[model samples]
Target: MGKKKHEPPPPTGGLDQNGLEKRLCNCICLCQLVSILSGVALLYLSVIVVSPSKQTLDAEFESTPVVCTTLENMRNSTNCSVLSCGEWCISKGGSTCAIIHAKVRREGSAVSFRDCDPVRATFCSAQEYNQTQQFICSEGEDKTGQCDALDRFMDCKPIKNKADDIKTEMTSLCRNITAIRDCRGTKPDGTQEKEIHVCTRYTCNALNGIYECSTGNCKKLENPTCVDRCSNLDMGNMAVVTPDLFHWGRCRSAFSNGTRIWTDQQKPLSMYCTRIRNVSATEMEAEDCLNGTLMDAPSFRQITNYKQMLGVLERNEEPLFEDQSFLPSEKTVEIFNRTKVMINVLGCVNTLRKECTTWLAHKGRDGSEGMHPAVYPCFITPHATNYVITDYDRQATVSQLVMASAVPSCLLLFSCFCLCLCGKTVGVNEFGLFFCKPCHKQDGDGGKEPAKLRAP
Candidate 1:
C-alpha cells in the first residue's frame, strides 16, 4: 500500500489559480482607470488654452513736448511713426530721412544718420538699447552758438527775469514731466515714432498687428506678458508694449559713432544687447536678457538679481529710481516706490487698469459695478512682459502638467479611500500591507462557513 501511494494531492489547486487571476484582473482595471483619468485631465487643459481675446484699445498721447536741441543735419522723417520710427532712423530720403532726434554722421560721406546711438536705439530695440541712453549735446557741441544750439538746448534756456530758475512753476512742471517721459521710452507709437517726442508715452499699444519692432520685424507678441498687470515695453519694466537700462542696443552713449546702430532682436548668445566687458562703448552688445535686465535696473542696476521688474508701470510717465534726477524729490521717490510695490502685487487692478480699460468696452460684471474687472485683469493682453514666462500660456505645457501631476495624485487618493473599506490587510512581510480584501468581499457563503465544510 505504501509503494502504491502517490504524492500528496496538491492542496486546493483551484483556489490558488483563482487568487492569481483576481490580482491580475485588479491590476488591469486599475491601469485602465488611470489611463482614462489622464485623458480627461488632458482634455480639460486643452480647453483653457485659447488665443487671447481682443482687449480694449484706448489711445494714449503725451502732447507736452520736451525742448530738445536738434542735431546738425538730423531731420524728422515722414515715416517717423511709432510703428516705423525705429526703422526710419536708417532710411535714405536724403540726409533728412533720419528721425528728427537722430544724430548725423559728421565723418561719413553720405547724409547718413549716426546709427541712432542713444536717440533711436530705444525707439528701435529696448533690449538692445535700455535706459542708459539720453538726449544731451556733446559737451563741446552743446554751446549756445553751436549746431543750432539755441533750438537744440531749449531745455537749457535761461530766464533773464527773476532768479533764472524754472520759467514758471507750470513751465517747471512741463519740463519735469517731459524729462521723466524722456528718461524712459520717447515717442513710442500710438502717434508717431520717427518724430522724437520729449514727453511721449514709452509704449507700443499692444494690439496684434498693431505694433512692430525695428529689428527682425519681430512683432510685440514675441515678448510675452510677465506682469499680471499691463504690457508696455518701455524702460521701466520688461512687460510687453513696455521696456528699460544698462543693457545694450538701448544706447551706447549720449551720442553715436555709427557702428552701434543696428542689432538683432531675436536675442541669441552672440546678440549685441550688452556692452562687451563694457568695452567698445559704441557697440550695443549683450549676450543675455537677464544680464541686460540687471544692468538697466533703476533701484539697483549694479546688482544682478534673478527677478525682473514686471508690470511696474501703469503710466509710462513715472520717474525711474535708477536716475535720482528723475526722482526730483523724496515725496516722488516714495510715491513711485509705493506704486511699484502695489502694482507688482495687485497688477493693473487699480487706476492703471481703469484707465487702460475704460475706453475698451469692458462690459463685465465689474464694469457694471462701476469698476474695472477685478476677477480678471485689464492689461492682461496678448503681449507678455517676459520671454521665458510665455511658455505657460502655451497649449503643450499645460497638457503635460495635467498628465504628470493629476494622474499620480488621483491614484494615491483612490488607494487611500480603498484602504479605508478593506477587511483583509495582509502584512507582516517584506512589502507591508501591499494588498487587502474589502470588508464586503464576496465569498461563496458571504463570510459564513461553507455548508460542505461546516461541523454537524
Candidate 2:
C-alpha cells in the first residue's frame, strides 16, 4: 500500500513559475538601468575632462615683465585664486613662463628666455648661422705676419726631344762665324796678317755653315747667313736672366725686335738664348737677373673700412652707409653690454631675418608683396590677439624700408598699416574689426570722443 501511494509525489508543491520568471526579469531590468546610469555618468566625466573653460586674468601691472618670485611672495599674492590677465609669455619649450606687460604682437612666436651672451646677441642674424658655425669650428683667420712669397721664374714649356734640327742649325751658325779677318782694322800693325776670331765657341753642322764668333762668347748678327737666327740687339744683364726667360724666347721664336717671325715659305726658326761654358776662355763670370713681384689688390683696403662700419652699427648707431657689410666692433660690444633696451630692439631685427627665410621659397620670384613670414613659433600672451594685427601692420613699416627692393607689395601693405594707425577714421574693436570710426563731433572739429571702447 505505501509503494502505491508514492505514485506522483503529489505533483511538486504548488510553485509560482510565472512569479519566478517575473522576479528574474525584474533583477535583469535593474542591472540594465544601473549600466545605463553608469554610462551616462562616464560620458559626463569625459566631457568635463576634455573641454577647458575660457577665462581671462585681470591683474594690472607696470610695463615691466614679472619674473619668478619666491615661494613666500607667491603665498602672499592676494589674487592667486584668479588667472592673471597680464601678458604670460611662455618660452618655446613651455618650461619657463614670464608675465610681461608688453604683448607679443605676432603669431607663431614665443617670448625667448634663454640667456644670450652679450657678444652673441650683437650680430645675430639667421642667414649668418652658417658663417657663425664656421667661425665656431675654426680657430680664426691666419693673422700671422709672414710674407706671401711668389714665383720668380717664368713658366716656360721646354722644347720637345725632336728639336735636334734646331740644335744642329744653331751649332752650324756658331761655327760659320768662328773666324774673321780684321774687317774693322781696329788693330793696326801696318800690313801684317792679323788673325781675329770670327765667333767664339764655333760649332759646325751641315744645315748651316759657319756661325760667327769673336771671343769665348759668340755675338749675334743683325742678319746672319746661317740657318739659325740670333738677336743683334744686346740682351743686357744676361747673367741675371734665368734659363726660363731664354726658353720662353725660343718657344715663341722671338726676333731682334721682340716679335715672332712667321712666313709661308720658311719654317719656324726659334732663336733661343743658350748658356754654354767655355773651358778655353780665361775670363768667365756668373751673374744673376731679377724677376717681377706680384702686386697686392685694392680689396685689401676693405679690412679697415669694415672695422669702421662695424663701429657705427653698434649702439643702435646710425650707420654711415647702408651697402657695407658690417661686423661687430669693440664699440658695438661696449654698447651691447651697457644697454638691455637696445639689445631688445636688435633682437627684433634678428627675429625678422630668422622667420623671413622660412617663407622665402614660397614667395613670388618677382618683386611682389609676397615674402617669407616674419613671424615665429611663439606662445599667445594675454594681449597677443589684441595687438597682433596692428603690430603686424606696424612691422610692415620697418619691413618696407629694409626690404623695399625685394618685396614691394609687402612694403605697400606696411604703408597702408601706418596710414591706418595715423588716420582718425580707423577704430579698433575688442573682437578685431577694422573700420572707419563714426564721427562723434561736428564736421569742423576733430573727432574728440575718447577711444575707450567697451568690451563686446
Best by lDDT: 1
Q: Residue 81, candidate 1: how far off, in angstroms? A: 34
Candidate 2 per-residue lDDT, tens place, 1-456, comes to 133221211111123223443443454445455545545544443332211111111111123221111111121233322211111112122111111122122111011111111111011111111121110101112421011111111111112222222333222211111111111212143342233223112121121211123222222222223211122212111111112222111111111222222221232111111131211212221121111111122221221221222222233232212231221122321211110110111111222233322222221111111111121212223432321110122233334433433243344445445444435543333433332334223222243433333444
The true-structure Cα RMSD of candidate 1 reads 25.8
Candidate 1 C-alpha error for residue 129, in Å: 26
Query: Candidate 2: how many backbone clashes?
Result: 31
| The best candidate in terms of TM-score | 1
State each model's C-alpha RMSD to the native: 25.8, 37.3
The C-alpha stretches of model 2 lying farther than 4 A from their native spots are 1-47, 50-76, 84-456
* Residue 131, model 2: Cα distance from true site in angstroms: 35
Give the per-residue lDDT digits (tens) of candidate 1, residues 263-350.
2231111011211223243332222111111222444232222122321222223432234232122222221111000111111221
